[model samples]
Target chain A: AQSVAQPEDQVNVAEGNPLTVKCTYSVSGNPYLFWYVQYPNRGLQFLLKYITGDNLVKGSYGFEAEFNKSQTSFHLKKPSALVSDSALYFCAVRAFSITGGGNKLTFGTGTQLKVEL
Target chain B: GAGVSQSPSNKVTEKGKDVELRCDPISGHTALYWYRQSLGQGLEFLIYFQGNSAPDKSGLPSDRFSAERTGGSVSTLTIQRTQQEDSAVYLCASSSSAGTYYEQYFGPGTRLTVT
Candidate 1:
């Protein structure tokens, strides 16, 4: 079974500083990793995904994630944090296989990121 | 372009009562999904529907939980004899297709409170 693990329950970062939200995964085959952000009372917004190629994937709002196969990790990063960036972050993973049988994503417990000014 | 929409942004019901949650996917989307978010459960996949085929209902938790998509555009999730444990945010999402390459767009979610 494919699963995602987000070790941090919450992360605190000062405004304008770089921020990192950790995520790791366990899967049998190649992993399709994704990062999503959700603000209060809003739906989750897709940040980026690692399908193929490029170990470092860049996404919206100056966010990016590094996909490390050896470490089995896909950690979300931002060069500079903004107060508005405070939200709940989720990491998800799915395995690549025939029949696309695993369309259902296994999501992590989620991390609450607080970017303080 | 309007994104996926869910009706009754918030619903409060008593235990043992029944409730229905609706989702309107993107105009041309062929795949729809329902998920539940509880305090500790994270996101639990409830069901998945692809095109006109039989839905993948493997994720549903109990027989009391059922869902259907009509005209391949809108979907409804009904829970019979709701329990307090069923109180959570129910989210609806839709993708252009069930392929791995397609991204799923989520709705704001309906916050269900069973008291």
Candidate 2:
């Protein structure tokens, strides 16, 4: 089984300040991690993913995330925040499999980020 | 090209009623997924369909929830005998499973309110 944990329910950050949303995972074999953002009355938008190779993955809207294998964590980060960036963020994990049998992802409870001016 | 699309932007049904949700995945995408997002339980995977293979229903919470992907393009999620607890936003997504592409593009989602 695979599962993801987002420790914070809400993170408040001021505009132009850096922000971080933490996520951790537990899965058999390796894991494929993803970040998504949901705005008001909108569906989830793909942010970024950690497949292999680099630990630092940059995504849309000037957001990035760092994958730490040792800590089993993939935390979303942004160097400078914008008030428009306020939204609900989710972290998901798909267990790695060579045969491609695992198609579904286990998602975290989600964390709400409130970026204030 | 168009991204994933879902029908019935919002729905309100009485308890014990049945409802069906529709999803049209991106053209040529071989993998489709269904998920539910509620206030209490953030987001939960419900089902998955990949090409001609059988669907993965392990994530479904109960037998009342079922889905089908027809001809590998469009899909439908049916919730039978709905209860108040079933209220949530049903989301649909699609991705190209060929090669190393694993990003799942999502649809706008259908908000279901069971009263």
Candidate with the greatest DockQ versus the true structure: 1
* Residue runs of model 1 more than 4 Å from their true location after superposition: none
Tens-digit lDDT track for model 2 on A45-74?
Answer: 999999998999999999999999999999
Q: Give DockQ: model 1.
A: 0.74
Interface RMSD of 1: 1.0
Interface RMSD of each: 1.0, 2.1
lDDT of 2 by residue, B1-115 (tens): 8989999999999999999999999999998999999996888889888889888888788999999989999999999999999999999999997333388999999999999
- For all predictions, the C-alpha RMSD in Å is 0.8, 1.4
Question: What TM-score does model 1 achieve against the real structure?
Answer: 0.98
lDDT value, residue B92 of candidate 1: 96
C-alpha lDDT score of every prediction, in listed order: 0.93, 0.92
First chain TM-score, candidate 1: 0.98
Give per-residue lDDT, candidate 2, residue B70: 90
Residues B33-103, model 1: lDDT tens digits: 99999987789889999999899998999999999999998999999999999999999999898887567
